[model samples]
Target: MSKIVKKTKHKKKGIKIFSSALVVLDSKSLVFFDHKTFFELKFPKNTVNDLEIVGLENLNEALHKFIKENKITSNNIIMVLNSNLFFEKILKDSGDIYKEISNFIELTPFEEVCSRTIQLDGETRILSTNKKLVTTIKDILEKEGLDIQLVIPYLALDKHSLNTENILEVNGKKDLDQLLKQLLPYNLLTENTVLNGKPAEKPKKEPKRQLFLQERENNPKSKRPLVLLSIFIALIFVLIGLVLFMNRKPPEEFTAPEIHQSMPLIAPIGSDQQEQTSGKTVENTTIKVVYDNNLDSAVLLTKGLSSLGFNSVILEKAGSESNTSKTYIDFSTNYPQSLRDKLIGETNKIFVDTVVQDSEVSDYDVVITL
Candidate 1:
């Protein structure tokens, strides 16, 4: 007997798919809106501790990893900036909106501000943020193959919400409907969203017209002062280079010493002798943690370093003096090309101050100031 043969196709399984990301940025955490489900992630403690400092390098890594592991491949991203993170100012109805915003931002207290403007009905509103934070966010998102569709202030939609008495200003369904309508022209909707029981098509956006919230006016006084300042700096650097070359020291020859039975915990600059100490000495290096007023943090750092197999001491601002003067190696210039790569990689792992000044120390490889 011959049996009829049939082929059956199997569908793919266990793949989580997401079309778009609605990223809500608040002071404490980030909430991602994805297909009727919300995922909230808290910022690590003290990540945004300073108002002026928004260091997101570590957060960027974590976010990118999350997106990759979850198989989220959508390119569209919409950001809702919290009122705490964004600044808003009303621009007066004047001759030039751009010029008014420029003058206003100059007088604002914040440093390195980036701004965007939007005209609603008849009033113009300026949305402002720290330039560094915006740049870092955009760079990270772009690196993850995502493009920012919209960056709107959280409070901007609060006005449209029905419940305005709440301090948090959480919006309702009506506000969301209004926001969706407002962003319709920008084609911010994904393919899965439905309108009238049919899939909504992404609208075609108009061609680019002009740059947004940028200083376009060609004022002679705007950049000439900066140009002159640059020339002055270049001349100063040239003068310093000449002085350093004229006073340069001669190179000294070095010889390797014979191997010893035991290495010293703390050795003199040229001596191989080890000194006896009551406290435990770790390895051949000593790390000093310096702080102005936070001795608690310094102590914590000392304990942390101790756990990491490094001998560390806490330096208080009152009675402690740091000694970093023993090292003779200029990290930037005095290394072979092959060793330079490894040396730079190692140095970057340690956080040093911008202007490093060598202090006096017997057996120290690095000095860190907090």
Candidate 2:
């Protein structure tokens, strides 16, 4: 368990930095430390629903007013869902995050390469070690009605006492048990531990119970065989891929017995009467023209946004959160879901419920409805 969460040791100087729950309302303050510092922020004075937060509204009013009053430099935040939110298959054909495991979970311009791809607040067990802390933070957030900007793990530390370089491996109950005893306060293991559904917990640690990593490893063995693990993982990938592949309107198709009926057979044909594939995609040089209703100057600024990579663009109408951010830009052709983030970033506008269905552009992508 420690091995999984341990910091990747480096030869460079190690910095002992203090951490705190950070909330960023404005961008200017923490622009320099985006990666190093965990952050949850919003533009000040932006109304989210019926509430408004002053970008300068000190969450820790007076008690620690020095942070803002004196312009101090400190805060540790970590509230990134992309870090550990869903099952992911590091794509072999594409590295773009907009290409994810599901159509249900929308992708955004922001992507973080933290410990896990996602960590659902509840009912998530794959990364069981972080569950308790995750749930604890989730409760606090919901109860306080305070949308968190970040929540660094309380057990997280780079101290030499817990040698980050050590390696421990075990398959049997005895070996696994010994391994659990080593990780002290950080270890979330139960004293009445269970292996193969039987009880086994050593009486130690302040808390009587903790999440035994070895026990979690055992849970899989009881449910299914090891050979099926590969098949299960593969099945999950296909399931997600199928969802993303839906609603994609390629130019042509044909029946092939060898091709699985479950998979859509779209043979992409360009304007040159050439057949291409998902593998041979290259960056486009064509201009995109957007006409969003949200912004007054959307048409004038549309050309610039297109140059940034939108194949063809036009606007539709916008929607709401939990609802969909919409944008229907009539291009000369079709497009894909991949356009969501680029469109959002380029125009500084969001499409909660949008789609681009253009017939004029012959070699465009797909008609996105995301």
Whole-model lDDT per candidate? 0.49, 0.34
Please, what are the lDDT tens digits per residue for candidate 2 over residues 206-296? 2332323222323434557666888999999999999879956786777766955897889766533331333212244234333324355
Candidate 1 per-residue lDDT over residues 1-370, each given as its tens digit: 0010112122434433334456666656666554434455666653454444455667677668765766554445566666666567777867565456556666544545555554555566665666556556656666887666665555334434411112112144454445555553322112122222233333224122122333333535567899999999999999999999999997787778987769667753321221132122345445554465556755665665665556544353635644542222232221123332333343344433334444444244445565
lDDT of 2 at 295: 54
Candidate 1 whole-model C-alpha lDDT, 0 to 1: 0.49
Which prediction has the highest lDDT against the true structure?
1
TM-score of 2: 0.16
TM-score of each: 0.38, 0.16
